[model samples]
Target: MPATATRADRSPRAAEPSPRGGRMGALWRVLEGPRALDVAALLIGVCTAVLTVLGLVMVLSSSSVEAIGSTDGSYGLFRRQAMWAVGGLAALLVLRRLPLRVLKGLAWPAFGLAFLLLSLVAFTSLGHSVGGNTNWLRIGGFTMQPSEAAKLAMALWAAAVLERKGRLIRHVHHALVPVLPFGLVLVVLVLLGRDLGTAIILTGILATILFIAGTNRKVFIAFAALAATVATAMVLLAKNRLVRVQAWLFGCEGLETSGDPCFQPDHGIYALASGGWWGVGLGQSRQKWSYIPEAENDFIFTILGEELGLVGSLAVLAAFLGLAVGMYALAARTTSPFIRLTTWGIMAWLVGQAFVNIAMVTGLLPVIGVPLPFISYGGSALTLALAGVGVVLAFARHEREALRREGAPDAPTPDPSVRPQETR
Candidate 1:
C-alpha cells in the first residue's frame, strides 16, 4: 500500500465516518423508509385540526355580541361557523381519499368553473356587496365567494400546466402563455369586484408558481414590477383604496384624518395594546362588541390577541409555521413535478394570506380585507383552506404508498435522548 493509505488506515479516524457523511447517511436511513410521510401527515393534520378547533372558539367569542344584536341570540354566528367547520372537515376527508390522477384531470375544469363564478359577480343581480367589496355571490340564503374557490383553482391549474410543459418550459413565453392569461383574467375579474385582498393573493399564487417553474429572475422581476405598477394605479384610481393606504400610513400615528377608513385599524391597535402580555381573558374582548368592524371575519386576529394574550397569539403563529414546514417537507419528499408545484402553491397561498391578514390587523400593512385562513370565519375561505390541507395530506399518503411499493423497510424510531445534528 502507498504511504498515505497505510497512514490513513493506521489512524483511528479512518474507522469512523466523517461527520457530514454520517449525518447524510442517518438522514437517508430515516427518510428512505415508509414512516417519513406518515410523520409529516400527522404533523400537518394535527396543526390544521388545532387551528380549526381554536378558530371555532374564537369565532364564538368574537361574534357573540354582534350575533345577538343582529339576529336573535349569541349562537347565531357561532352556529353558522360551526356548520361551515363541519362541512369543511367533511370536504377535507373526501378530498384526501380521492386519487391524485383524478385531481389532476379536474384541474382545468375547476379553473374554468372558478372563472365562470367570478365573472358572474359582475353580471348577476345576485352579486352582494359587503364592507365595500362586491365579491359575494348570494342567491337567496345560499352565499358564496368565488374568489376563495379561485385561489385553489388557480394553484391546481398552474401546477397542471407546468407539469405538462415539462422540460420545454425554458423560455418566458412558454411559461407565461397560459398561466399569465389565466391569472390576468382572474385578477381583472377580482379587481372588477373591487376585492384587492383576494386579487393580491391570486397574483401571489401565480408569481410563486412561475418562479418555481424555473422562470428567469429577470422575467420574474419585470413581471413583479409591472404588477406593482398596476396595483399602484388601481389604488390611486379608487378613492376608497387611496384613503385606506393613507389611513394605514398616518392613522396609526394619531395623525389628523377625516374618514371612516382609519376606524377599524385604530380599534385593532387598541385591542392588541389592551391585551398586553396577558389578555383580558377569553370571551371578554370589549373591541368585539361593535368597536371593531369585521371582528370575526377580517379582524379575527385582533380578538385572538385581545382574548388570548401575546402568548396565545404567538402560539397560533407557531402552529402556522409548523404547518408550513411540514408541507414543505412533504413537497421535498416527492419526485413528481405536479405534486411539488401543487404543494408549494398551496403552502404559499395559505401562509401568505395568513401573514397578510395578521399584518393588516397588527398595523404592519394596509388593510385589504383578507381572512386569517383556517382561523377566520368565512365559509368559503375556511373550506378551501382545509381542502388545500387535504390535498397535501393526499400527497403525503401517496408518497407513503410509493415507498411501500419500492419495498422500503419501516423507519427506525427516533430516540428522544439523541440530539439531532445537521449535515454540512
Candidate 2:
C-alpha cells in the first residue's frame, strides 16, 4: 500500500471518514437540501394548514345548526371541507415537486385552456349558476370554479409575457397592445359569468405582476384608473351589488333578527360584539343558530370573530401577514425578475383578497362575497388558490438553489454601484 494510504489506515482516525470526503458529503447534502424559498414555502404551507384546520372546526361549529336540518347529517360541511383539505394537500405536494421551467413552458397553453373554460361558462348549457353568479361548472357531482382557474392562468401568462419582453416591457405601447387586451378579454369573460369579484382579483394579480416587472408608472396608473371605473360600473349595474354599495357608503341597513336587508351583516356584527374580547367561548356562537346565513362560506370570518374573539381574529390576520411577508422576503431575495414578479402577483392576489374579505366582515368595505382565501370553505376555490401558491413557491425554490450554486452568502443585497452602471 502507498505510504500515505498505509499511514491513514493505521492512524488514530482510521474509522473516521476523510475530511475531504466529509466536506464533499456536506456540500452534496446542502446541494440536495431544499432551498430558502422552499423553507419560505413551508411557512406558507403551515399558515394555510393552520387556517384550514381552524376553518374546518369553525365550519363545523357554524354550519351544524343548519346542516342537521338539511338533507345531509351534521357532518355534511365538515366532510366536504375534509375532502377539500386532502385534495389541496395532494396538489401542493405534487406541484412542489414540479420544475419551475416546466410551468414556464406550459404558461401559454394553460392560459388558453383556462380562457376556453372562461368562455364556456357563459354558454348557459354547461355552466352552473348559484346565488345569481354563473361562475361554476358541473363536473360530475362536484362544481369547478373557472374564475379561480383564470386567476392562476393570468398569473402564468403575465410572468411569461414579462419574461419574454424583458427590458422592453416599460414601453406604454408594448404594455397596452397585448397585455391590456388580454386582461380585458379575461375581465369581460369573468363579468359574463357575473363574477366581478374574481375578475377584480385577477386584475389585481396581473397589475402587481406588471408593476414588479418594471412597467412605467404612468401606464400602471392609467390601467388602475380604467379597472376601477369598470368595476365601479359593474357594481352599480348589479342589484345586490348596489345593496353592498349602500351599506358601505351610507351604512343604511342595520341588524335585524330576520327578513331584512342587513340581516347577514347585522348578525355578523352582533356575533362579533357578542364574542367580546375573548369570544363567546368557541363552538357556541349564538348568531350561528341560523341567525347568521352562509356562515361556512363568505361570512365565515364572522364566526371566527364571534367564536375566537378579537385576539383570535388578530392572530389569524397575523398568520396571513406572515405569509405575505415570507413571500415578499422570497421575492426580495430572487435575482430572476420573473420569479420576483410571480411572487408579487401571488402575494397581491392572496393578501388583497384577504383584505377585501376581512374588510367586508368589519364593514370597512362593501360585502364583496369574496372567500377569505384558505380560511374560507369551498373546494374549487381553495385548491386552485393553493396550487397557484405552489407554483410561485417553485419559482422561489429555484432562485434559492441558483444562489446556493453560486457559492454566495445566504443574504443577498442590491449593489448601489450596479444601478448607475446599468443606466449608463
Candidate 3:
C-alpha cells in the first residue's frame, strides 16, 4: 500500500451510519447467533403451550352447553380434556428426555402396533363408529382413536426408514417399496374404517416424508396424481361424502335444517359470519348451543372464530405459523438426516392438519372431519400431538448438545480488508 491506514480509520464500526439500519443489523446478528436453535426450540415450546392453553379455554367454552346437558356438568368436557392434557404432558416430558436412538428403535414397534390396531378397527367387532366412521377402539371403559396414534407412528417409522435408506432414496424402487406399501396399508385400513379425512392426512404425511428425503420429482408427481384419483373414487362411491362435496360446491345457504348434509357447514359459516372483527365474545357463541355439530371436536374452529373474532383466529394462525417456522429452522440446521426428516414429518403432520382444519372452517375446502391440531377437543388427538412435539424437542436437544460438544462459534464475520477481484 502507498500509505497504510490507521487502526482507527480501518475500524469496522465506521461501516454504518443510520441508527435504524444499525438496530436492524444488530437484530439480524442476534438472530444469526449460535443460540439461534435454542431460540427456535423455545419458540416451538411457547407456541405449543399457547395453542394448547387456548384450546383448553375454547373447549371449555364450546363444550359447556353440551356437557351440562349430556354429561356431569358444564365443566365435564373441560375436566376430561384437562386429564388428557396431563397425560399428554407426561408423554411429552418422557419423550423429550429420551435419546434419539431410543426413539428410532421404537419406530418399528410403534408402527407394528399402529398397524395391528388399525387392522382391528377396520375388520373386527371391537371397532367403534362415531359420526359414521369406525375408527375408534373401545377397551373396558376407555375409548381411543387408532387413526390418531397411527399418524405419529407413521411419521416416526417413515423418518427412520427413509433416513436409513440413505442415497438409495433417490432410486424409485427403494423409495416406493417398503415405505409406499406400508403407508398404503395404513391408508387402506383407515379408509376401510370410513375415515377419509384421517386417510388423507396419512397420505399427506407419507408424501411429506418422501419429499423431505429427496425423492424424484416425477415420482412425487405420479404419487400425488394417484392419491387424488383414489380420493375422488372414494368420494364418488360414498353417498354421504358425495352429498357433502355437493353441498360445499354449491352453497350451504338455506340448508341449516338439522340432519341435512349442509347443516353443519351452513351453521359453521353462520358462526364465522357472526364474529366480526371483535367476535361475539368468548363463551357467548350461540352456534355452540346445539347448533353446529361437533362444536367441540372437528368444527371447533368455527366456535373459536365465533368467540374470539377475526383477531383471535388470526392469533391462532400466527401461533401455528411460529410452530412451523421453528420446526423448519431446526430441521434445516441439523446435520443428521433422521433429525431433519423427522422434524419435517412432524411439522407437516401438525401444521398441515391445522391448515386443513382452518380451511374447512373457512369453507375454502369441503368439510372434512380433521381436527385442528392442539386445539380440537379430542383426547387421542391431543395426546398424540403432544407426544410428537416431544419427539421434536428431543431432536432439538440432541442438536444443542452436538453444537456444544463441537464448540460451535457465533456467526462468521466478513473480512473488511478483502477487496473484490475483477473478472475478465
Give the count of colliding residue pairs in each prediction: 0, 0, 0
| Candidate that beats the other on lDDT, 1 or 2, i.e. the better one | 1
Clashing pairs in 3: none
Task: Please report, in order, the local distance difference test score of every candidate based on alpha carbons.
Answer: 0.83, 0.77, 0.86
- Give lDDT: candidate 3, residue 200: 91
Q: What is the C-alpha lDDT profile of model 2 across 209-251, one tens digit per residue? A: 8888888899988898999899889988976787767766766
Best by lDDT: 3
Off by over 4 Å in 3: 1-31, 252-258, 408-424
Please provide, for model 3 over 320-416, each residue's C-alpha lDDT reduced to its tens digit, 9 standing for 90 to 100: 9989978976886677788888888889899999999999878899987899988899999999999999999999898788766545367354466
Mark the regions of model 2 whose C-alpha exceeds 4 Å error after superposition. 1-39, 253-259, 408-424
lDDT of 1 by residue, 130-229 (tens): 8788999998799999998998898889999999999767787787788888778988999988888899999999888888878767778888898899
TM-score, every prediction: 0.87, 0.84, 0.88
TM-score, model 2 to reference? 0.84
For candidate 2, give the lDDT. 0.77
> Residue 31's C-alpha lDDT in candidate 2?
28
**Cα lDDT over the full model 3:** 0.86
